[model samples]
Target: MRRPHGVLRTADVEHGHDLLPPTPPTTVGVIEAVATGSPRRVVDQRANAARVADLFADPAQRQRIPRIYQKTRIDTRHLAIDPLEPEFLEFSRKPATIRERMNLFFEHAVPLAVDVARRAVENLADPAEEIGQLIFVTSTGFIAPGVDVAVVKQLALSPTVNRMIVNFMGCAAAMNGIRTAVDYVRAHPDKKSMVLCIEVSSVNAVFDDDVNDVITHSLFGDGCGAVVIGANQVHQPLAAGSVVIRDSFSHLFDDAEDGIVLGVKDTAITCELATSLPDYIYQGVDPVVSQVLARNGLDKAAVDLWAIHPGGPRIIEESARSLGIPPEAAAPSWDVLAEHGNMLSVSLIFVLERMIRDTRSAAPISTGVAFSFAPGVTLEGIVFDVIRS
Candidate 1:
């Protein structure tokens, strides 16, 4: 395949080694900095449940709502809309059409994306114009010229910066985006790149008595996360405790495409969660993690930390059990879940940011693995090490 116009080929740079195979790039990608942005409104589970309870007229369902919300173990979430507001309550009862939902998405998603991207860039040692690639990931919204373009224009990123948009991949999109960044930096070690994940689940809210809808509503919150990555060759002396992406792994559970369904309907965006998803995650995480570790000549015990996506309380617990790690090892995932709920593709990045900060004072070298699940019952894993400066 032809390289893009400005991306240099090794052959072009090494004048005397024409007959030899190209050497590997001498730099690894480092996660320079990470930043997160949330909607201004903080929605407490009790008030959220109370507002949701009004939507279900049945006394029995109303009684079940609070119990279901409590079971999620999410105390508060950052929602783009206030659940207790009369206007939002009215909209929940009479759901908006798909067009209206998309409008809500456009109005809120771009500004959040730009804000998070700005923060991530601010943490970088390089200027904003030095960012050569921009990847925007979201499962909750779509637009032509999309959030990527808005981010570029708003952040004053290079006009010629490479751009990618990953849409509708659900929770796993963030890992995939990071992997894409790793690939980019490995190929173009001189360039810096960024991955921005923003999900406005509140805009796609589904108000229904269905248990799946109730669980989905209880678990997701609106938020955006951004990570700035660049080859170590370009950004030497990145912030202390910056993580280097060592390797990545991905797997799709056989015949499990229907495990989590996210689609759009005339009434609103729709989400259907399978009851067996926790079981799927429990059975699959071990193999994906084992293979990645084994390939890297390490094992589970060698890892100092884990950034398991907090898809839900059960998902986190079962994943820890499968990995044979103590519950506290997955505490970052649990804490993020309780504070922010699931922000879809953005949740794992939030966990990553927290782990990097909390472990800043640890030993000189710390190994960590991150995992995220999406609609395919897919698992995306990354092996990384934090090196203190």
Candidate 2:
């Protein structure tokens, strides 16, 4: 059965109060690395923006309007070296080399993922033995034992460390992973859980030379982000600064599953994104946001921080406009998109990490709303408070 919102709320009272054992503070630590194999061949947004426009202007794809292809302020996109190199045209032109392609892709992807996970975990002073759980999230590549195993092998974490893999959920899966960690930390307030969100989207590219493929190719880049959540009671100086996970809420739009989907066909994965996506978010997101805030006894005006997924430029604009979020409130999201094309599941976490890192003063009883939309037409939402240590 689907759980109703606000069925429970813990961690509300002051730290030393008798209502509950002091809730262990949960904080986010981020580490991000650009994939080495994916070279930035085309490093300008305007040029790519024009390429994006031309791709959708084809007569056969006239129905796929260019307007829906939001003008990404993406100055550059990373591409795998062999794929982008002129000499690789022979390999690119071929079809039906699935096993060979998969092998090549994983070889490059795994190392970058390991590097990203290692760097991120190293940011936390807690020894590997103390990390009781490792949650790995990704949609672009698949491998047995996966990132969880890779992290365990590299970090020398306990063999008993609880491991979970959240896969194929698209951009919103990152929140799902975080929500899972939140529940774990809430249940075991003495344990620490690490979340590693890595997306090597460039590897999943389909070279169909079609409009849908072009848009997908142009909009995504390679990136990975890792975060750590721990119980607040242990209280190891609170990391000097951290964003506390006060509460989180998720809402899924059941009727709109066809609005966005990512699926595999033959040797390539296709991203089927409807042009009406902006309309869907604009029409649906407000009520969900309202319901989520109301359940927390918050009004629209009470939310001071919004770490929304930068799905694209139009999605971001429409979401902000639909939800009545101010321009300043959406600035960080826009900045992320301009600097790095959407990294799918990992993008929202990156935004949240930035907010936590950049806070210089005590943030208002700040309510951060991080959300993203994807297949199943999911609207994954997470709300948290930024507490000053």
Q: Estimate the TM-score of every prediction.
A: 0.89, 0.80
Off by over 4 Å in 1: 1-25, 92-96, 123-128, 209-211, 233-239, 359-361
lDDT of 1 by residue, 84-194 (tens): 467765676574467777778888998888888888998556545678898889988866767888888887777899999887778889999999999998788788889
How well is each residue in 1-389 modelled by candidate 2, as lDDT tens digits?
Answer: 87564333344334433454444345432112111122344345555445445534356554343433445666655544424444443565467645555555566666666776666566556547667788888787777756668768877778888999998889898888878887787677667777887776655565545656667766887677777776564333444345565566666675777778887655655577787787888888889988888876887888878887886887788888889876567777877777777778877876876776666657534567888986877788776666545
- Candidate 2 lDDT (Cα, 0 to 1): 0.67
Q: How many collisions per candidate?
A: 0, 4
On TM-score, the candidate that comes out on top is: 1
- Among all candidates shown, the one with the greatest lDDT: 1
Model 2: which ten-residue window has the lowest total lDDT? 29-38
In model 1, the worst 10-residue window by lDDT is 16-25
Cα miss at 61, model 1 (Å)? 1.1
